[model samples]
Each structure stands twice: as structure tokens, then as C-alpha cells.
Target chain A: EPEVTQTPSHQVTQMGQEVILRCVPISNHLYFYWYRQILGQKVEFLVSFYNNEISEKSEIFDDQFSVERPDGSNFTLKIRSTKLEDSAMYFCASGTTNTGELFFGEGSRLTVL
Target chain B: TQLLEQSPQFLSIQEGENLTVYCNSSSVFSSLQWYRQEPGEGPVLLVTVVTGGEVKKLKRLTFQFGDARKDSSLHITAAQPGDTGLYLCAGAGTNFGNEKLTFGTGTRLTIIP
Candidate 1:
């Protein structure tokens, strides 16, 4: 089965540094999303992207966060300045249909110190 | 913000025992999905329930969508040790552009052999 793939399975960076997490969604998937889970907390939606633009975002997705579909296959999330609270597991998901069945990539664990 | 609350944050059961995990919310959703996540990995989609009062079975696992589309349940019959993982239920609203999902507080299950 085709699955979404992500780069940098684990990333550790200092506070106030820029970090980028990359994902390659399934070949034919149309919708993409980014979600984060703080340790011992529920997963929180960050942003959703479709048609090369952000469809919707949550309050947690503030100005410091940005998502881009640089190419047909690559979707990236950038955090301009990482905060200690930003340490979490970020997951990238893709779906071919609107039924909410998404395939998630192995998350990128971001550790800010 | 929509919140999905899952019952029994943690469960440990012996092999061959039956268990049910619930996901509930006050807001109605267009669809609900169940995912299983292992440690150090992203969630993997287990099933999607769209219509109200819908039921779907995958092998020994049975999923049910509530009549009001505001809740869901996963029941495993005679579960095996392989059924251990963190189970999450996500709800998708009727947003215009590829709806974003609101995830529930997860249920961590450990199946003892």
C-alpha cells in the first residue's frame, strides 16, 4: 500500500531557531494536513492544505507556522522560531477523498531546547 | 473549537477479552475515523464511519457511528495481544475545503498475553 512519507523522523533544535519538516503525500492524494500532539495530550489540528493553499487553520497555527506545497509531491511545514512549548510530534496526513480517511506518515518528533 | 472525548484513557486486558472504546462529542460531524498509533509512529487509519448509526467491521473489530453522528465506538471481540496500541477517534466537520479533523483524547490499550 502507498503511504505518506516524511523526512527527519526526529529533529532537535534550540529555541528561536527555524525548523522545517517535510512530507511527501501519497501520489494521488489531494488533501493534506498537519497535526501535532504534545506529550500526553490529544492531537491538535494545525492546518489543512488543498489546491496549493491553506484551506483552514486552528488558533495554534499562528503566524510563526507556515505550510507550503513546493512541488507536486512535497508538502512542508516551517516554524520560523521554535518555542519550548513547540516540542511535540508532528504528523502529516493525506487523503484521496473527502471521507476523512487519511493516511499518515510516521511523525517528525521536534524537540526544542 | 470542537472537542472529542474518549473514555478510559488507559486499558489493560488479558488476551481473548472483549473491550469497547468510545469517542463522544457535543458537535455533530460529517464523518468519524478511528486510528491506531504505535509508539514512535504516526496514526494509521483503522476505519471511517460516515452515516449515522453506521456499523463497520474489520476482522474482529467492529465500529459504530452513533445515530446523532456525535459519537462512535470500537468494540473488539476476543482481542489478541496484537491489539495493543493507542486508539484515536477523529471528527470532521462540514467545512468547505477538505475539512480538518478534530482528534479525541486517545485510549491507550495494552493487551496482555
Candidate 2:
């Protein structure tokens, strides 16, 4: 089965640095989303994208966070300034319409030192 | 906050034992999905229950949606070591709201051979 794929399975960056996490959603899926999980915490919604624009975002998604679909198939999340609290597992997901069943990528672990 | 409260945060069971995990919410959802995640990976969808009181079976695993569509449960029968993982539940609404998912804290299962 086709699955979402993410690059840089693990990332380590200095605080205040810029970092970008990349994802290739399942081919032919329309909606994309980004979620984060702090160690020992529940997964939190970051943002969701459709039609190359952000459709919805949570409070955690602030000025430091941005998402783009620069290409037809790839969705990317960029953090302009990384914070220690930004260290977490970032998961990318895609889904078709209707019930919107999501398929998530293996996740990109981000560690802001 | 739209919280998904999951019961039994951790479980250690012998192989061939049965287990059930619960995900409850006060906010009604358009659909509830169950996912199993191994450490260091994103969650993988196992089943989705959209309608109230719906039940779906995937081999030895059974999923049920609550009568109010506000809760769901995952039951595993005769679980094996391979079934040991972090089980998560997510909720989606029908509001054209980016189709983002609100996830549970997850239940960690350890099956001993």
C-alpha cells in the first residue's frame, strides 16, 4: 500500500536555527496535515493544508511555523526559529475526502538543542 | 480543549491474552480512528468507525464506535508479541476544518512471549 514518507528521520538543530521538515504524502491524496508529539505527551495538531494553503491550525502553530506545498506532491513544514520545546516527533498525514481516513508517515524526530 | 482520554496508559500481557483499550471524548466526532504505532514511527491506521454504534473487525482486532459517536474502543483478541505497540485514537470532525485529527495520549502495550 502507498504510504506517506518523510525525510530526515531524525533531525538535530541548534536553538534559534531554521529547520524544515519535508513530507511526501500518499499519491492522489488531497488533504495534508502535520502533528507533533512531545515525549510522553499526546499528539497535538499543528496545521493542515489543502489546495496549497493552510486550512486550519492550532495555537501551537505560530509565526515560527509555516507550511507549504511548493510542488504538487510534497508538503513541507518550516520553522523559522527553533525552540527547545519544538523538539518532538513530527508526523505528516494525508487523506482522501469523505470520511477522511488519515495515513501518517513514519515521522521526523526533531531535537532543538 | 477537545480531549481524548485513553484508559490504561500501559499494559503488559502474556502472549495469547486479550486486551481492550478505550478512547473517550466529550466532543462528538464525525469519525473515530484507531492506530498502532511502534516506537520512533508515526501512527498507522488500523480501523475507522464513522457511524454511531458501528463495529468493524480486522482479523483478531475489533473496533467499536459509541452510540453517541463521542467514544471508541479497540479490542484485541489473542494478542501476540507483534501486536505490542503504542495504540492511539484520533477524531475528525465534519466541519471542513482542515480534517485535522485530535489524538489521544496513547496506550503502550507490551506482550511477552
Candidate 3:
């Protein structure tokens, strides 16, 4: 079975530094998403991307967060200035359509000090 | 904003016990998905329920979508130690082509052998 893949299984960085998480979605999938889960908290949606642009974002997805599908295969999430609260497990997910079935990659754990 | 609330935040039972976890929401969804996440890993999709009052079974697990499309449930029969994990329920909005999933608070289950 094809699955989504993510880079940097774990990342630790100081507050106010830039961080980037990369994901390679399942081939032939058309929709992509970024979601985060704080320790002991529920998973929260950050943004969704389709057609090489963000289709929708949640209130938590502020100006500091940006997502790009730089190449056809790689989708990236960048945080310009990390905050202590940004520490969480970030998951990358992909789906072939709006049908709501998505495959997620093993998350990239980010710890900002 | 859509919200999914799951019941019995944590459960621990003997390996042969049968258990049920629920996911409920005030807002109707186009689809609802159940996922299982182990420590240090992203959520793995277990099943998706789309039509109202639909039921799907995957081996020892069974899933049901409420008639109103605002609630769903998962029942596991004769659970094994391997069934331990955090279970999350996600709901997709009725908006067409918008694939963002709003996740539930989650239910953590541990089956003791």
C-alpha cells in the first residue's frame, strides 16, 4: 500500500527560529493537509492545499504559518518564527478527492524551547 | 467551527472485553472517519462512514454513522492487547471540495492481556 512520507521524524529548535517540515503525499492524491496535535490535546487542522494553493485554513493557521507544494511531489510547511506553544506533533495527510478518506504519514514531532 | 466530541476519554479492559467508543457533534458532516494512533506515530485510518445510518465492519471492529450524520460509534469485539491505542474521530464538513477534517477529542483504549 502506498503511504504518505514525512521527513525529520523529530525536530528541536529554539523559540523565534524558523522551522520547516516536509511531506511526500501518496502519489496521484490531489488534496493535502497539515494538522497538529499538542501534547495531550486533540488533533487540530492548520491548513489544506489543493491546486498548488491553500484551499482553506483554520483560525489557528495564522500569518506565521505557510504551506507550499514547491515541487509536484513535496509539500512543505514553514513556520517563520516558532513559539513555545508551537511544540507538537505535526501530521501530513493526503486524499485523492473530497471524499474524506485520507492517509496520514507518521508525524514529525516538533519541540520548540 | 465544527467540533467532534468523543466519550470515555480513557478506557482499560481485559483482552476479551467488548467496548464501544462514541463520537458526537452538533453539526452534520458529509463524512466521518475513525483513526488509531500509537505512541510516536500519526493516525492510521480505520474506517470511513459517509451515508446517514450506515454501518461498516472491519474484521473484529464495527462502525456506525448516526441517522442525523451528527454522531458515530465504534465497537470492538473481544479486544486484544494489540488494540491499545488512541482513537480519533474526524468529521468533514458539507462544503463541496473542502477536505479539511475537524478531529474529535479522542478516546484512549488499553486492552490488558
What lDDT does candidate 2 reach at residue B48? Answer: 86
Q: Which candidate tops DockQ?
A: 3
Reference-based TM-score of each model: 0.97, 0.96, 0.97
Which lDDT values do the candidates have, in the order given?
A: 0.93, 0.91, 0.93
Off by over 4 Å in 2: none
Q: What does DockQ come to for candidate 1?
A: 0.71
Predictions ranked by lDDT, top down? 3, 1, 2
2 against 3, candidate with superior DockQ: 3
Once superposed on the true structure, which residue ranges of model 1 sit more than 4 Å away at CA?
Answer: none
Question: Which residue segments of model 3 deviate by more than 4 Å?
Answer: none
User: Model 3, range B1-113, lDDT digits (tens) per residue?
Assistant: 78899999999999999999999999999999999999889999999999999999999999999999999999999999999999999998876446789899999999999
**DockQ of predicted model 3:** 0.73
